[model samples]
Target: MIGYLVLALLGLFVVAFYAGHRRAVASVEGDVARLHSRPSQHGLYLALLSCVPALLLLVLWSLVTPAIEASIVRARFAAEVAEMSLPQVQAFIRDARAIAFGGIAGFPDETKEAAAALFGTLHGWSVRIAVVLSLALAAAGYLYGIARIAPAFRARHMVERTVRGFLILCSVVAILTTIGIVLSLIFESLRFFQQVPIYKFLFGTHWSPQSAFTGAGAEEGAVNTDIFGAVPLFAGTLLITVIAMLVAAPVGLMSAIYLSDYASRRVRAVAKPMLEILAGIPTVVYGFFAALTVAPFFRRSGEALGLDVASESALAAGVVMGIMIIPFVSSLSDDVINAVPQSLRDGSAGLGATKSETIRKVVLPAALPGIVSALLLAVSRAIGETMIVVMAAGLAANLTINPVEAVTTVTVQIVTLLVGDQEFDSAKTLAAFALGLVLFCATLALNIIALRVVKKYREQYE
Candidate 1:
């Protein structure tokens, strides 16, 4: 609530700043020395100065407050719980926190009262301090800008630079988040490798994570600990991705071509968005469609052909996933194909080439980079997709190449490993992180290769 108030205050300040600057500029005109910027630029300069610094501080405060409060709470309890074992103390702290935050109840009366008092005081003070500090900074900046609104202020250029920097910071934050996730996955995978050999995980033929917790004395040196082969999951993921690409690529590309090259303007206007409507459908809907409808149809069809087929078949899941990816491929490819210079098409036509020949040899080749990028993007989506596979693809990790067989992908395994009740410290659960690391690396490699391919294709046109 305080954050919203701060934003509201900042917005009001901007409006005031703009109004004041415009009034000042209109009144002064050419009577005084030349103004450093236009009236609007001067307003923007004041507005940015009033908001940016305070917003930055508010963001920093928000991020650090939780850690600080947690530390304080831990310190308060440390002496009281010192006699307890580390694990027990930790558990107690967790329970106390839950009670304090209204997540759970049934704490000791004294502990609950103390926790409530502490949390209320800290939270109230934190919010008050944040609001006070931000308001003060904004007021100061606003006043300074107002005072400097004389003809000498270089407001426009400074505001532009500040806005550019702000945008850059936002982009950097997104990139940094991706980097952090990849690093976390790498670290957890390293921990997993400590328990199971990397070679066994990568190359072994059998993959039964449930076996890691088997037997009466499985905690001791288990015989089957080294059987964590990822071949089947990898193969299944690849097969599904390939099948999806096969379904998406030709259909999406041809759709793009028709929209860009052949469709009448009115037809294109109606059909483009209609086709893109496929993208809006949720994956969960697709999941049920695959599981309830597609899988049964496949099974019945296979039975008719006198062939053995699993009710939850890979073909069913892969085909559904492919359909899900069609919009991504078509939309991206369409934009890229349209972006190709019309001069190239015109030049081709002047050389006695037919429209189909011009498109085939000229437009498609030129737009190949974007098409490859779109396909790679779709491949990444297929690899990471969870819900459809979880529902349609069976959980059995069969190490086979047959598309008709029941197969599981990495995401399915990850979902199963982490779902329901599970210990986070167990090998079974930790294997999900290991799988995530592999998936991340695989997708990153695909994107890089795709980017390179696109760049090379662009160079040919250049």
Candidate 2:
């Protein structure tokens, strides 16, 4: 029903646009030069007036309808719900809604069937009320806006102001969302800190949340704070990120240089897209390749070379993650390198420099900031990757830096802690938020450092 109303509003908006456009021309007897704004601006203003208010009404209606329906159903079946707990009441409402909407319900009884029937009736009435009121509002807004269209009307100004306000609202929303996330992480991490000290999480050597006190009511269960030591997780994350950068940075940078300076147009058109296809492949598929192919290949090769390699090792995950990030680094670096003015290369040639010398001495220095930024961004991507790590690097949480050994990153540990139904108040689950907070801080710091590096090099180049 709501979808139908939205489609109707869209149609009305289109009609309003053409109507306003014609009205603007008709208002001034086809003397568009006398009007303050263009016919298109008038049309846009009318369209926004027609649909914006109706869209807001529909949003409000959608939020209110479920609550209103749940209340009416509960009041009608008061006797059935009187003895139920809050969760049970919520469950009953859910089941009734599901049954009314042709969804599969958990437990459908005669009481629930009656509730579902009532729910369907209420939903129909509510949708009718919403549609009628929304359409009326849209019609009224259209009439008012059209009536206001005159020779002196500033439709462009009004439309611009509305768009500007919308952009500001979007920016505010993004900032607030970031602030909210950080605050929530801090709040949850503080709760985890109450269970386990911050110092232990920061400095202790071991990483074993499985043995930590995770039960809600068991006071007798040993709360081993030392097991929550995150040092090993940090080491594993650093090890993997370093390995990934080792594989990605030089190779991606060299490929970008080749593509930007050496490759012909024909070669670039084919090679660049083929290289970028790596980035388009799903990370889960990369994880599978890492697990099934890369890890096993490494293990077999290790045996041949008289080396011991874990079946699920950090080396495999890091290498595959590096492969995944190659496109990101290569694309960014290629664009940056290409952005270096041709005059710089021409000047270098005028100085009797060879192509290799000009590239090494001039082009690379000019593009260093962007190249560094790309590599840092790739590092951030590597640090956040969980699938490849989870599949290739086993959840051993070993404090070793050996790439051939099994190790888990901070992201993997965070995921491991939060999987399935969890008691949020327990140290185990809260630990995920704690790890998240640390990761967020680390990423933010990395970005700040990258910005500084970019600024410094950019100043020199400029």
Query: Would you estimate the TM-scores of all the predictions?
Result: 0.88, 0.94
Q: List the residue pairs that clash in candidate 1.
A: none
Residue-level lDDT of model 2, residues 1-462, one tens digit each, is 789889999999899999999999999999999999999999999999999999999999899888988998999999999999999999999999999999999989999999999999999999899999999999999999999999899999999999999999999999999999999999999999998999999998987788776534435775778788899999999999998999999889999999999999999999999999999999999999999999999999999999999999989999999999999899999988988889999999999999999999999988888888888888888999999999999899899989999999999999899889998888889999999999999888878877887777667656
Q: Write the per-residue lDDT of candidate 1 for residues 219-261, one digit (tens) a residue.
A: 5645355557898899999888888888999999999999999
Number of backbone-clashing residue pairs for each candidate, in the order shown: 0, 0
Measured by TM-score, the strongest candidate is 2
Candidate 2 versus the native: TM-score? 0.94
Q: Pick the candidate with the highest lDDT.
A: 2
